[model samples]
Target: MYVYDEHDRQIAAERVAQFRDQTERALAGELSEDEFLPLRLQNGLYVQRLAPMLRIAVPYGMLRSEQLRRLARVTRDYDKGYAHFTTRQNVQLNWPALEDVPDILAELAEVEMHANQTSGNCIRNTTTDQFSGVQVDEVADPRPYCEIIRQWSTFHPEFAFLPRKFKVAVNASEKTDRAAIQVHDIGLQMVRNDQGELGFRVHVGGGLGRTPMVGPVIREFLPELDLLTYLEAVLRVYNRYGRRDNKFKARIKILVKALTPEGFAEKVEAEWSHIKDSPTRLTREAIERIQGYFTEPAYDALENATELLASQRFDNRQFDQWLSHNVDSHKKPGYAIVTLTMKKTGTPPGDVSDTQLEQIAELAEQYSFGEVRVTHQQNVVLADVRQDQLFELWQSIEPMGFATANLNTLTDVICCPGGDYCALANAKSIPVAESIQRRFDDKDFLYDLGDIDLNISGCMNACGHHHVGNIGVLGVDKKGAEFYQVSLGGSSHHDATIGKILGPSFAQEDMPDVIAKIIDVYVDNRKEEEPFLETYRRIGIEPFKERVYA
Candidate 1:
């Protein structure tokens, strides 16, 4: 958890006061809905289906135990007794009164958090790998950079009103947990060359909506120091030439397509010529200062793996199962990265009750290093769990219904609130997610379909990230009736690609069988022990398409 500096604290406090006035003016009818729309959006307030939903920005999904406790208090005091963690690494409270939004923002600001740029047509929260600092393969933690970008973009005078909402994601690892980078407005991947100099691989114009595109690599390697200046050039190009006539065609992705990656790169290169190495360019000192914020947490050195923990693994089959699926390798010895799954069998994915949030906070103090991370996959992560205490932690979490061992499995579905909460939605996505989970509840069956990512969204904003799942399902409306569109072959890892739609949409009731048929295709054709992605790549979508359509 990066603590805010005096400057950071001041800006957040001032911004709250500004938003409070904006909210009061809007409510008092001094500000019309048109005038208030962007203002409210900038504060992460959305007037959705039934009420105002406040999306609290959790930058890079990183949080301190105290911050998590504040969020729990926010949910308990203001809205319902729970909150929905979104795929963008943000959290949403569904039932906030429009007037109380200012107070909510004030509460968040007290904890050095805010909803700035959370929903506006400006740069949104800069998401990064949840395990940025803790993961073994990470080149460097991306959070400091994310925080810098957050500060720069907060009220960027020129970009306040863009053609459409813009998103930027940074990943510093060899593996891409921050998926489908090819589909973001800007994707930054930290890279080291043969010379061992650090920089980034810049991808531009990747996005998913009605038109999904894998971002094109415009710059193979940009020196890390020129990050801000180079980014400004990219945004300058998009802000100047991006479409304003049609909202549907206004995204940077559309403009990138219109210009082509090569041509776009030329434009950006030309702009960068004047701005590169400018005063805004990051200096060694700046980089060091930012890196200092994310320096590794102190860990006790314990070289030996506890034999007692090894024995406990075999003694409790349930704990063994949890260790197998929910635990990830840690860079530290005698410690593990534990994913506290929220995708329990029958509940809505990412919906954490107030009590569970408090429990997680307590657990972070007792087991983890007083920190927890909310992952993009809608689960809580206890980043540094001691191996010896694994069984006790499992015992604590299992009763709260948080120990479902479905990480990367089909049952570990990423879903949005959908029609139940979203006004933009055409059908219910949560129920569909549950139905799919029910059909694949058997662990043996799920394990056979190894490392499958199933994502669903009620409508086309692709909030559920349906465009990048190994098995993607999109809900739609046909003549006022609910239906789902299935797609296959999409992935969100290092080799990211968008899934292709199968055919005509299927009726809602037909989804379970359709899913079963797709799995059957995998089972019948997969070469021994091959994962879903490997099998899909080797066999292509032809066989699955045949089985699914037939």
Candidate 2:
């Protein structure tokens, strides 16, 4: 975890002071709603359906125990006792009073936390893989670079008010894209060339919403030193040319489409040719300083816990299932990455109560080096749990409702707070998520189906990333009546693909049946134990569509 330096602390504190004054003015009627709108949005506060929702950035989904405790405190005092974790790897407080927001933000600053850059048409949180430093599959940790960008874009004057909000994701995993890089405004995949020097393969224009696209690779290999300058070039181009007339057409993806990836790349390259060697270009020392902040925790000298874990697995089937689903391979032999699922049944996918947050903080401090990671899947990661203590950790978390052995399963659905909290939503997503959860609450069935991503969004904003789900559900308003649309074969992992709609949308009551029919088709056509995505690919969407509509 990157600790805030004095500069970081001072900047956050200053922002609190600035926002406090703005909020006070707004509350006193000195600043009208129109004037305060952007100011409040810039601070991550949204006037949603029923109340003011404040989104707190968990930069790259990283958090410390103390920070988690602080978040728990804010949830306890300012709003509802539970807060919803969002798909952007951020947390949202849905019931905060307008007058209390500044105080909440000030309290957040006490723990080096803030709500800055979490919303508005600016660069949002720069997210990456939750298992960045600890995972075995990474070529290099992407957090240092994410941290670099976070610092650069926090309040960059020139790019502060772009035509539309921009998102950037960085991933170094050679085999997996937990960051879903292809769907971001800018995607940086760290790669090592023939000389084995790390750099990035840059992709641009990818996004999902009204127009879903898998970005084209703009740069095959950008040297590590040129990271910031190259990024500057990309943003400069988008800031200059991205549409400003229509909100729907304002995204960089639209620009990428109009100019074509090659043309856009040429534009960025031309811009980079001038500033590539400027002070903005990262130097070896600067890179090292950032990298040093993410140094691996002081690990214990212990043998591989393979035999011990296996013994425990044999003794308990539940433990074995959880180990298979929730645990990930760590870079260290004796350690594992534990995903504490927030997808347990009856709860909105990522809602965490204050007490649960406090307990998780305690568990992280005791078992995982006092660090926790919020995942894009709306889960939490204890990235360095010793394998020897896996069983105990599992036992401890299950009662907290965080040990649902459904990582990447159908039940481990990623969802957004739709009509329930979002004014922009046409229909409620929580009930749909709950309905699907109840339909397949059976652990054995979900496990049998293999890895399937079922994502739901309240609307086309795609906050739930429904377009990437293996079974995608989007809530639509049909003549003032709520309906659910289904898409099959969508994936955000390797070779990311946007799903195709099955057929006509259905009434809300029929969503689970539609999903079950899609499942039935997959189970029927699957080859061996093929995953839902693989089966969908092999048989094409026709079978699933036919079964779903039939």
Candidate 3:
């Protein structure tokens, strides 16, 4: 976690004061609703369907235990007693009073957190793998780069208000992409050439909305030093030429489509030529300074607790299942990365109560070096848990409702707070997610089905990232009735692809069965040990479509 210096603290305090004044003016009728729209948005406050929603930025998904406790306090005192963790690794409060937001901002400032650039057509949160530093297979930890971008983009005068909201993601792992970079406005993949020089494989124009697209590779290799300059070039081009006439078509992805990838690259190159050698070019000193914030923690020198873990697993079936699903191998010998599942059977996915937040903070402090990481799948990660303490951690978390053993399974759904919270949503999404989770409650059945990414969004906004789910569900309105649309073969991993629509929409009541039919088709046709995604690709969407629509 990066601790805020005096400069950072000063800026955050100033922003809070500014927003406090703006909010007071708006409440006092000195500013009208139209006048207050952009101001509120800039502070990550949105007027939702029923109430105001405030999104708090969790930069690159990193959090200190103290920060988590502060969030719990905010949620408890200011709004409802819980908050939703978004797919971008940000946190959203669904019931904050408009007047209380400035006070909330002031509280967040004390913890070195804010809601700036979280909304309103500006560069949003920059995200990466939750396991960034702990993953063994990565070329290098991408958090330092993510932090660099976060500092550069926050309140950037040049990109404060783009044509539409822009998102950027970084991925350093070659084998997997926990961060869905391919679907961002700017996606950077860390790579090395034959000379062992670090650079990025850049992708542009990737997004999901009414028009879904997998961002194309715009540059083969952008040198490490030119990271900020190249990003500035891309944003400059978009700011100059991106659509502003129509809100629906204002995303950089739309601009890239109209101009074509080659044309976009040419424009970016021409723009980069003018300022590539400027002071924005990263230096070794600056990069190392940012890297210092994310160096390895004081890890205990201990061998893997292979025998102890084996004995524990042999004794408890529940703990063994949790270990298999929620635990990941860490780069260190004695440590393991544990994902605290937020998708319990009855609870809304990713909705952690204030008590749970406090518990998580305590657990993080006790077992994971007082640090936590939020995953894009709406889960929390204790990235440095010792292997020897796995059983105790599992037992402690189970009572707190964080030990669900359904990491990549069907029950571990990625969902959004749809019509229940958002004015933009066409239908309610939480109930649909809950319905699906309830229908797929059998642990044995889910374990046999294997890794499945099932995402649900209330509308085309794709807040749940429905486009990338192996089996994606979308809420749709047909003649004033709520219906669900299904998509198959979608993935957000290294081989990212937008899901294809299965067929005509089904009544909300039929959603659970429809998903079951899609799974049935996959299970019946899949070869031995094939995951849901590979099976869908091998068998194609036709079989699943026929089963689903039939």
Candidate 4:
């Protein structure tokens, strides 16, 4: 909910003007594709399998009603009538003309949004928990810190052209909703010491792609004020020493593995020695000012319990189903967090139509604050819905096709816009997700499965976070035939781990049956309604692997 300051406004506008000129040059053939590639990438444009894709940054996944409307308008006017919300909490417009990108950026700037540093070797968006301010277990709100880092990393002269693209995430919650301190280039978790002072638990080298590894803790408790300076040290060491000859080996994860966690920490510390208390360190006053921007919203003091809500829950079994799946507790007593499930049966995981976007904007204004959040799992969040209004909100959401009650069930899948939209993908991921959903449409059975995350990536890049899903499916091609590979036990939680593959890949036709076998193993072997993950951990992959392969 941080409004753009005048300085932010001016900077965004100026960047758009510069890009408009660059766009003109590129279209006129004054600049070749090679010349425009880096520039376009810096502005968040990528030439995909079908067309040029423009990624618009949604900082920390927060968006005002006005901003959402602007995005809707941009897609309606410039590209296709829909945008794909990415796991990084950004939106990708799939069909923007190369010439019209500058106009799109200008429109985004009007809403205090931009695509800068959304790609390239500089730090990408500094994501935080989607429920940052509203989560019941927040140790501190992480947005202000995210905003600070966003400013520092945006077009930083020193880091603009790194050996490879870098990403960072921070979490300030007891529970890790942001999946921070996991498979990130750098992960920061906020903590309080024995003396009750704010600090960070720093993790270095974790990354996902062809290689996935959980980051190792390097610094146990870095003080709050030294965040920027300490991060500068980490980046400086990586920039100076990370491999430049091979793009595959250029990520910080590779360097961290080569140097070992202890050695990486030492290198960063040696670099930090000269600049530990430099002027770059965030000041108390500055932190306070940034924090002020993220203060909690005003709420009515009336009790939240309602007879209408109770009666509706009693009257409609469908509403009750949605309530069970879509609602989450809020830090505020009178409020709740509502996830508007985009994963309706048989649809693309995160696709929303232009009309649906407008309706969501209206629903956000009616049921909660005039704000919505795009979650990493590609669902929209109505973060401040009143508990009393849950049923009516569900009714409004039902007609818009947003009332799928499968928040974290097997149906709530995370899938990339694979071969359908992305050229990098070897096979289509969305249809595979739909196939699995169709096979598992039994509501009672899915609910019994309990909090499962099914993620599908079209390729080895792991963009869909396939490696961390309780049920991960990756699509690969063999001799012009699309095959699906299954992995089990991967999780992105307090006990994070990448999953192991279950033998050879299966043909697309065999995937649903393969999944059924995996589930059957869990059902037969589990102890008293244990979740899929719990069962997997208890019995290990051997049981499922044996069943599937045998």
Candidate 5:
């Protein structure tokens, strides 16, 4: 919803021109692979097993219809006919030619989008709740702050390269931790103090990957004005002290672990004392300037669609199922947030064909004010869909393979394009997801099983965010064979928890059966109306482990 200002346009265009020159030099053999590695990475290009992968940033997962259409065109013209949406709310063009990426970036620039800072150890995209401004119980819209941070972090000269990659997420809603702020490098929770003044509750050093850990609260409440200054202090502390001796231990999480949360906070506070009142502190004028860009759209005076939607629900069971799973209550009475499910069986999760992308762009324009939100769960969001038009919207999307009613069900899996495209992957994640989806094809069974978050990562990097899923699956390497490891009871909600592995890894073929047994344990032991996670936590992982390993 934030349109690019003229400044934004000029900066993006200049960066593309610079990159185009760099790309030309690289292709002409003026720069070697090692020389171009960091250069290319800074522009979000990675050389995978098959071809170069170009990650295009979707700032805070927000896109306009024009941007989506431009992306569709890029997928059609430059790389393969499809692209994969990532958990970070970015899209990866897997088969992009090295020479063609500059053109891709130029095209993205035309739409106020780019691939900058998507890789190369700088702060990645600043993500927030997909339903940021629309969620019913939201404390505040976090996107304004997310956008501020995005602009601040885009090419900060001081933080261009750090010990390791950094991530930041903001959550303005206490009801659901949809942004998974607890598991980010810097997690900011918007809160009101006892005096009713708004501020941030800061959490630092949380991350997944080789070392998985939840963030610890560094500051109970930092004044809103001090956000940028306090963050500068945290980054300065980390940059000064974080280990560069070993790449594996270089992340701020490792430093936090070494310092302990109390010590990390103390260091950050010490650093902050020197700069708390610096010019870098956000001013009321600046804050309002950024917030102005996210003002609400001119909503129509429409009646709530309760009666009509209920009637449709009664008439069509399929539509009813989709309505239950994919729809979320909106702050506006007559509107709803609908997640266009991307987790269909057989196809890789988070993937969309060129034609499908074009259609989604059209649908967004027609039904949701020409806007779309890319969800961290690998789905697309039509945040302003009229409740009255749910049936028609579903009909339009269903034919394009976007109307799976398994929003949080087992089949609504979050998965990475693993061995298929990623050279770093130990095993194939798409097939694993497909197998489980196929096994649980029965709709009634999935619905009865209740809300479950199933995430699969190809490796320990946790690209699919497997660590926080209710049922997390990680592909492992076993004696040169691809084996699957299972973790249970993980969650990325208000009570976020890391999953625990269930004994030995199994052959790829046995994963579906293993997941089925885990579900069986839950189904058999759960209390009336208990969600899978609640049931798992109540019985503990022992029962599921015993059953899954049996």
Candidate 6:
């Protein structure tokens, strides 16, 4: 994790003071609601359906244990006793009083955290794989690049106010697309040429909303030094020509569609040619300095605990299942990456209580290093857990309601705070997610079903990233009544694709059954050991549609 220096601390303190004044003025009736809207938004405060929601950025999803404890304290003292983790790898306080937000910002500043750029039409938090440096297959750690992007984008005067919100993601893994870069405003996939020179395969206009799209490859190879300059060029083009007259069509994806990929690339290239040699070009020293912050921790020289783990797996069926589902191979020999799933059957997905947050911080400090990473799937990750201590960690977290053993299963749903919080939502998303989880409570059945990415969103804004789920459930409004629409064959991995609509929307009551039918179709048609996504692609959505709509 990158520790804040004096400069960073000073800026954060100044922002807190500025927002305090702004908030006080608004509360005093000195600033109108309309006048305070942008100012509050810049500070990541939103007036939601019932109360104010404050989003706190977890830069590239990294957090120190101290920061987590600070968040727990904030939740306990200021807001409700719990907070929601978002798919963008950020955390949200759903019940903060409008007057208490400035105080909350001040609290966050003490821990080197803030709510800046978590909302509004500006560059949002840059995210990457939760298992960035620890994962086995990545070409190099992507967090340094993500940090670089975050520094360049945060409060950049040129891009302070864009037509709409812009999101950027980086992926360095050779085999996985955990970052889902293809669906971001700017997706940077680290790659190397024949001479082993590091560069990025850039994708632009990838987004999911009313208009879903897998962003096209704008530049096949952008050199490492020009990363910031290339990004500036892209933003410049979008700021100049992106739609502002209509909020619905203001995304950079919309602008790219209107201009076509080639035309958009030409514009970006022309813009880049003029400013490519500017000071923004990252130097070797600068890149190395950022990279230094993310170097490996003090890892012990130990071999994998193969024998002990095997014995443990042989003894406990439940622990074995958890190991298979929640644990991932680490780049280090003796370590493993563990995901603390938030999707328990009864609890709302991603909602962590204050007590649990504090406990998790302790667990991170005791088991892994004193650092944690938030995943895009709304889960917490202990990225450097020793393989030998897997069972104890699993046992500890299981009782804490964090060890669900449903990672990538149908029950591990990605969902958003819909009508329950967001005024923009057409229906409630949490209930739908809970209903599905409850219907598939059998752990054995879920294990048999294999990997599935099921996402739910309350509306077309796609905050839940429903478009990329293997089975996507989207809430829709029909004559003022809430309805649920289903989509099939969507994926957020390396071969990303938008899900196809199954059929006519169903009533809320039919969602569990509808999902059941789709699962039944996959089970009946799939080859032995095939995943849900592969089966859907091979057999096509027609079979699932027939089973679901029939």
7-90: candidate 5 lDDT, tens digit per residue: 989999999999898889988999898888888898999989799999999989999988888989999999779989999899
Evaluate residue 442 in candidate 3 and report its C-alpha lDDT on the 0 to 100 scale.
96
- Tens-digit per-residue lDDT, 1-550, candidate 3: 6889999999999999999999999999999999999989989999999999999999999999999999999999998899999999999999999889999999999999999989998999999999999998999989999999999999999999899999999999989999999999999999998899999999999999899999999998999999999999999999999989999999999999999999999999999999999999999999999999987889999899999999999999999999999999999999999999999988988999999999999999999999999999999999999999999899899989999999989989999999898999998899999998999999999999999999999999999999999988899999888888888888888799999998889888888998888888988999998998998889888998777767
Candidate 1 Cα misplacement greater than 4 A, ranges: 304-306
TM values, all candidates: 0.98, 0.99, 0.99, 0.98, 0.99, 0.99
The local distance difference test score of each candidate is: 0.88, 0.92, 0.94, 0.88, 0.91, 0.93
Candidate 2, which ten residues in sequence have the lowest lDDT sum? 541-550
Per-residue lDDT of model 6, residues 410-492, tens digit only: 99999999999999999999999999899999999999998899999999999999999999989999999999988988888
- Candidate 6 structure, TM-score to reference: 0.99
Candidate 1, residue 115: Cα displacement in angstroms equals 0.6
Where model 6 places Cα greater than 4 Å from the true spot, the runs are: none
Better of 3 and 4 by lDDT: 3
Candidate 2 lDDT over 1-550, as tens digits, reads: 7888899899989999999999989989999999999999999999999999999999899999999899899999988899988888999999999989989999999999999989999999999999898888798989999999998898999899999999999998989899999999999999999999989999999999999999889999999999999999999999999999999999999999999999999999999999999999999999999999999889998778888998999999999999999998888989999999998889999999999999999999999999999999999999999999999999998889988898898888899999999999989999999998999988999888898999999899999999999889999999999998988888898689999988889999998888888888888888888888988888887887667666
The local distance difference test score of model 1 is 0.88
lDDT (tens digit, per residue) of candidate 1 on 222-305: 988888999999999999999999999999999999999999999999999998878878889987877787777678987646
Q: After the best TM-score superposition of candidate 3, give how far the Cα of residue 518 lies from its true spot, in angstroms.
A: 0.9
Residue-pair clashes, model 3: 0
Task: Evaluate residue 394 in candidate 1 and report its C-alpha lDDT on the 0 to 100 scale.
Answer: 91
